[model samples]
Each structure stands twice: as C-alpha cells, then as structure tokens.
Target: MKHELKGLYAALLVPFDKDGQIIESGLREIVRNAIDVQQLDGLYVNGSSGENFLMNTEQKKTVFRIAKEEAQNEIKLIAQVGSLDLNEAIALGQYATELGYDALSAVTPFYYPFTFEEIRDYYFKIIEATQNDMIIYSIPGLTGVNITIDQFKTLFENEHIIGVKYTAPDFFLLERLRHAFPDKLIFSGFDEMLVQAAISGVDGAIGSTYNINGVRAQAIFKEARLGNVEKAYALQKESNDIIESVLNMGLYPTLKAALGEKGINTGLPKAPFHPFDESLRPQLKSLIQKYNL
Candidate 1:
C-alpha cells in the first residue's frame, strides 16, 4: 500500500441494487478486474463515479471497507471522503485512513456558496483529524468552486495536502499547476483529455471510463508522457469514441451494463439516476464488443 501514488486509477464505479444498497459480491469482482485484469495502478473509491453523494455515511464506509478488503493492499486506494457535512468528511477520512487507504481525497464542498476561507478550513480540519496524506478533488463543473493558483498555494501550505484530482478542461490552468507544483501529484480526472493532460505533464489520471477501457488509458498516458504524441493521440481518439458513446447513453448505468455483459453483476445506479435504457442495450453491447471492453 506504500506504492507511488502516481499512475492511472479507475474512479471506481460501484454496483448498487435498486434499493440503493452496495452489492458486495459485484464490488469484489470489480476490484479484482481493476487490479488483475485492467491492471490499473489504483482505485479512487467513493468518488463521483461511485455515486458517493447519493450514499449515506455508513454506506460510504461499507464501500471503503469492501474496497480495502478486496484489494488487500495489492493496489493503491484513494478514498474520497468529502461531504457537505464537515464532520462526516472527517469521520470518513478517519475511517478510510484507519482502514489503510493509501491517501484521502475530498471534493470541494458544494451546494452552499461557501467562502474560500471556509473551504480551506474544511480540508484543514480533515487532514488535522485524519493525519493522512490528502488529495484535493477539484471538479469545477459539479462544484462550481474553482481553486486558483494562489488559492492552491494556500492549500499546499499544508504539506500533507499532497496534490489534486484536476477534473476541469482548462489546459492553461493545468500547465500552470504543473509548473507551480512540480513536486505535488496532479491527477487528470477527465478521461477524454488524458493525452492532453499527460502532454501537459500530469503525474497520472483518475477516470471513470478507466473501469472499462483502462488498458488503453494506461497506454495513452505512457505514450504521451514519453513524448509520443502521435501514438498517444491515437489511443485517446479510441477512448474518446467509447467515452462519447457512454456519455450519450448514460454514464453510470451504461458502465454497469458494460460490466454486466462481462458477467460482473454490476447492479444499477442509485435512485434519481435512471437505469441504462434497454432500447440502447444493443448499442451498448456493440460498443463493448467493438472496443473489446
């Protein structure tokens, strides 16, 4: 578990029943696929792709525990412990850290227009409480909270706040972040732009699509970082095709369906998020076979 925290990680997709319960069996299978089959460097558990926001605290803890047990320290695990309730975030951070998660990540608190000072304090409290390495999860599209370079400087002041899951499409900001914090680990959160981010010098990536297309993702990152833009771009284009289809069909459900086709028992997305459209099943199946996912 003391592995280098820099590499391709699947932003883990959870298997949930219609009752919004974690399907433990399916979860184990998915973990094994990521480690033994996909051969990803890590698993970013309970992040957005796992529908963390939709699960209760205890359910989140269940995911943390299950992922750790299944992984058994074979692969790196970064638990996303962020919540609107600061205490919940801290408690989950403590839970994950104690469970031996390699690192803890928290999305910027959203829903209320929290001040920058308040946001800074949120992360500080979690780190102080858990005393574990932290990765700032910066996804501006969902949270609407953009951390500028100066703000990042303030956050990085906490030596324990190791790096960030940079999800936005702002290449300029990414280049600036790389130049500004060369020592910190910067993980690209968007799969479609993995090549671009790798070209811009991202240390690694954490992506939802990696759950299905991880081998290609790893190749894209490796080739791009090695200055093989042509080779990297080729893989990126292939990945983008899969991503474009998945997004159009529905993200979580389509992913679950893809895994289901492989007999993984990936149940369904939590409520309010609709299940994969049965009408699109043929297209999803075709995508899976076409890409050999």
Candidate 2:
C-alpha cells in the first residue's frame, strides 16, 4: 500500500524503570497522550531520542510491539529498526512491517568504519529483506557515517526506498536533494532546525523535542508552509529556547520529567543514562509552564 506519511512526528521517549526495564504501562500512556491529546502527525519509534542503541533485540522488539499496539492505527508510526548488525536490522524491519508499522527507517551503520559501498549494501540488504518501504536515516554526527547526495541517489534508486530522515545541519545538501528529488519525502531530523528544513521543502520533521513541544513545532511548520515567516520564526524561537533548556537539563530525563509533569508518568531513563538533576525539576517545570508545553 502507498503510505501517506508526512508532517511533524515525535521521536518518542522510552520510559524505563529504575532497574532498567521498559515501563510498558507508562509508555502506553505516553503514546496515547502523544496521539490523542498532543495530536502530533505521527510517532518515530526507537530513534536516537528513543534510546534504541542502549536496548537489545528483544527489548527493541518489545518496544516496537507496544508502540504499535497502543497506537492502534490512530496515527502513523515510523519504526527506526536500524542497528549496527545488518541481520538484526533486517529482522527488526521485517518484524515492524509484520506488526503494521506505516514505514521503516534505519540509521547509517556506525563503528568498525564501514565504507560507503558497505553502507549501500546494508540498505540494499534491508530493502531486499522486507516488503516495507524504507526511509534512509542520515545522522552523521551520531553514526559518523553520512549518505552523501550521490549515495542517497543510489539508495533512492530502489523503488521501495521512499525517503530519508535527515538529521544534519547541511542546508546546501538539503537544498540540492529537494531540487533533485522533488517527488521524494524528506523529513528533517533536528527539532531546532525545522524552520530551515521546512523552508528548504522538507515534508516534515521527526524530532526528540517534539515529544514535549509538538504543538508549537506543528505551528512553525504550518505557518512556514503558508509563507508566514515572522509567525514561524517567533514560534521557532520559543521552541528552541525550550530545547536549549532540555539540552542543559538532559534530553531523555527532561522529556520523561516533562511527561510526568503532564501526568503521563514515564518514570526515568535506563541506567548508565543518568536521571535529570533533581534540583533542575523546578527549572524544567517553570520552563514548561512558560512555554505552555
């Protein structure tokens, strides 16, 4: 089936208990709130914001299953099934497809320094393994591997490869891609960069900060799309200010805490990912209230 995937999607936060277990109930509630109340365009499950790297295969599958079940087809779900292991990535892709995810995205492989040819092979392997359409995730900073314009063209040559979740700040390349592939979908990956991305013709954005600030992000995109630069910039500035606080307080913990403050109770981050400083909760709360998040 042709997918109607576009617009502002939140890279969901996975809530874990103190013992580092996925808090399924809490997560279900968070997803529910994100869809039912926040009214976001979609959910980007198991991405960088979702802490996918820290979890194992079983844990990742469990998250995929829970997110799908709770979403109940109410909103679009893009499963980030990418991993360092090619076989494992394929398995997750097939699993998510079977579970009814709307689309699948995979990060460029990291560590061990794979060549561009290897990266090309990796995406080819994934597209060949599953019938699901793919979105190439190009986050150069984290994965240390970037799909250059030529590489992206190679991947998009696959009829099933629909688009990309581009996280870098390279507007020149972004402009080039938009100009080259006007028909393909390109969702910006950085929440803070949504205005520029939207102006450059990005279809939408998938971001961690959107988990809390989706309403405003949606406004920014809507206004920008309609040529309301002043309004969009004002909203973008507000969103960026909040994101700045999130970066200072910590991304995952601040997200969890904000969710809890909203009464969703996402608990805390998994171990080795430290909790937000308790002292900063007041500051976070004030910021959230200030932004009406």
Candidate 3:
C-alpha cells in the first residue's frame, strides 16, 4: 500500500552533548515531546534543521533507529535519507525502509552542480533501491537545484514517487504544480510561508519551527482548510513572529536552547554550530514563555 504523507510534520532537531556527541536520551525526549505532547501528525527526520549535513553515516543511522524505536509507529515518520553521494542515499533509503519508516524523502543532490538528467537519475536510483514510496525534497536555497514543473511531472510519473517538500518562495510555480498534479502531495518547507503554501493548495507542511509552535501551526492549517482565511492569517502572523525571533537568535542554537529550557535537554547542536550562551538562556526562556510554546 502507498503511504499517506500529509499533515504537520516536525523537521526534528538532533541534540548533541557539549563534547559534540549525540545525546540519545535527550534526542528521544525531544522526539517524544514532538509526537506525544505536541501531537504533531508526523516527523521529518534528518533535514537541514536536524543537522544532517554535519553528521556522518553512522550518526545518521543512529538517529533513524532511535526515532523509529521511540516513535513505535504512533505517528507517521518520513526519513530524509538524501545525500550528495548517490550510493549513500540509496543505502540510507533502504535502511530507513527496513526500520519501518512510513516514507522516504531526499533533498536534491547538491554542491556538485549536477545536470538535470543527473538529478533525475539520482531519484530514479533511490526509488529503485527500495520499495518504499519517495517524497522529493526541493529546497533550492540549500540544494541549489529546484525541480522544475517539467521535472516534477517526469518524477510524479514514476509509480513509487509520491510528492515533494516544496520549499521555494515562488508561489507561481507552486500554483502551477498544484494545478498540474492535483493528486500529488506537496508539503510546504518554509514555516513563514506556510500560509501562502496552504492557500496555494499544499497538502501539508514540514517545518523546523513546528517543534515548538505545532499547536498554532495545526490551528492555522485547520482554519485554512475550513475556509477561515482571516483566522488562519492571524495564527500565521504569530508563527512568523516566533520564527523571525528564532532566525535572529541563530536558528538551530536558539531552538536547542528553547528546548533545553523546556527541560528537553536538547543539548547543543553538533559542531561548527555553537550552543546559546548562559546569558542567552534567560532570553530564550522569556521568548518561549512569551510565545507560550
């Protein structure tokens, strides 16, 4: 059976010790909060917000294992197994499938300036590697490659291919994709842009900010689906305000700090990315309380 990849999914944050080691307990707590407390519809594991780029293969696999074991099929789990290495991508995809992940997503192969054909081949290879359905992760800002409408059509034609995590700000293209393939699932990648993406008919959202603000995000989506634009707009504005503050405070670090303050022990982000200082802890605490996160 095909997997149903829809609704508000948190692009989970990976916590690490001060020594830059994965804090398994902290990570499990965070995932539990996202699933049981926040009541998110699902999780998007190992995305940019999860610090996937900084992690090695073993670390990535550990995250997948822990998330799956802890999640225990309570909610949907979409494992992001994408990488620049095609072989690694396939390996991770298969591994995640075996771990009972609901679906697999891969960000467009990045950094090497691959041709369109090469990108297509990358997806083809991953889909061929496992029987699990795939979601194309299109974050042009990070990947430097945006799958065009034509490319999307080509991909959706594949039986195992399901949908995309559409991250770009271009609503025109998003509208076009929706018009062209009404049945395909399209997840909004930008938390700030969720209102517009939902307005444009995105099936759901996978956002970093949802970890803390999931209730509000869910309200926005529910209101929009109910045709209450005015209410949805108000909630979206609140979400954007929180996200703006997070961006200013350093996205990953601030998020971890906020989680830590909430007693999740989200640890520090894996390295090259610094943890928020003791001074900033008070500020993050204030922000969290202010937002009622």
Q: How does each model score on lDDT?
A: 0.94, 0.88, 0.89
Ranking by TM-score: 1, 2, 3
TM-score of 2: 0.98
| TM-score against truth, every candidate | 0.98, 0.98, 0.97
lDDT of 3 by residue, 1-293 (tens): 34366799999999998787789998899899898777899999999999999999999999999999999979899999999888888999999999999889999988998998898888989989887898999989987897788988899999778899999999999999999998888899999988888888889999998888898999999888888999999999998989988898899988888877778989888879877767766777778888899
lDDT of 1 at 217: 95
Clashes of each: 0, 0, 0
- RMSD (CA, Å), candidate 1 to true, equals 1.1
Q: In candidate 1, where is summed lDDT lowest over 10 consecutive residues?
A: 1-10
lDDT by residue (tens digit), candidate 1, 1-293: 22399899999989999898999999999999899879899999999999999999999999999999999889899999999999999999999999999999999999899999999999999999999999999999999999999999999999999999999999999999999999899999999999999999988999999999999999999999999999999999999999999999999999999989989989999999999899999998899888889
Clashing pairs in 3: none
**Local distance difference test, candidate 3:** 0.89
**Among all candidates shown, the one with the greatest lDDT:** 1
Over the stretch 161-255, how does candidate 2's per-residue lDDT look in tens digits?
89999999999999999998887889999889899888888998998888888888889999999999999999999989999989988888989
Question: Model 2 segments beyond 4 Å from truth?
Answer: 1-3
